[model samples]
Target: MRTHWLSSCLVLLITTLAVAQKNTQGISGQVLWKAGNFMPTIGTKASVPKAVPVVREVYIYALTNDKQVDAGEDAGFYQKVNSKLVRKVKTDKKGRFSVTLPVGYYSVFTKEEKGLYANLFDDAMNINPVQVQKRRWTKMDVVVDYQAVY
Candidate 1:
């Protein structure tokens, strides 16, 4: 009887943990970096440009408008942003990262040496905008390629 009771308690604990995890929502995705020559060469022995997984820090900020970001001379680099930073996460060796956040719209940026980097925008000019839904993990893949020549 004692063994039965202990087993029941263990099962209850596991179930509760699983339910708690399922109820939390956030974002999960990978980051890739493309560098060097990306333009196609017609000559023989030409190789395709490849993007590799990059291990870096990812920043989540409140949904940012175009005016909020101070654009840099390069395409994707930002000098700074006026939006509030919501959270930050570091990517694993394989460039995979996950973060728990409330359901809302957010802007994603990857840490760079000079500044922050993000290459996407919406119709309203929202920079790197992502939406986190209730009880769901939003998937977003960020590619950093400011150094690469097109």
Candidate 2:
């Protein structure tokens, strides 16, 4: 019957998807900040005695681990494509985050990219990178230690 054939096809598709499941891993961490003694910028040095802001939201990125890919002529195209492949995660309250990603190399970061002060530390250094492997949970901690230039 026609109904029987349709059911058979649907069952076949579901089985194929389950068999092709990709192995993935989880990543979790906190974003902490240490009070700064000084942050030198633009030929001027400023002192930050104590600045313990809330550690509410931290960003985690499972970035594509290829830095040597040359865009060549179409430089903008490469950046666009690579940005699309980035796996981004944000922490919840209490500075906690967990993300499941495919097994591969990744570059993690804790940079803040929101709010009116977002562009303040544009020239600051990036956070250290971390790697995640197959079916494993990687616990990585990040620290923020920069002050505003102005």
TM-score, one value per model: 0.82, 0.46
Runs of candidate 2 with Cα error greater than 4 angstroms are 1-24, 38-85, 113-127, 148-150
Model 2 misses residue 142 by how many Å?
1.4
lDDT of 1 by residue, 1-150 (tens): 999999999999999977976899999999999989988787668786799999999999999998998988877788988999999999999999999999999999999987899888999999999999999888889999887888
| Cα lDDT, model 2, residue 5 | 100
Clash totals in order: 0, 0
lDDT of 2 by residue, 1-150 (tens): 999999999999988855543344767777555554545456556555543434444333334333422233421112212333355556665566777766655555444432101111112222234567876778866545444221
TM-score of 2: 0.46
**Candidate No. with top TM-score:** 1
lDDT of each: 0.91, 0.48
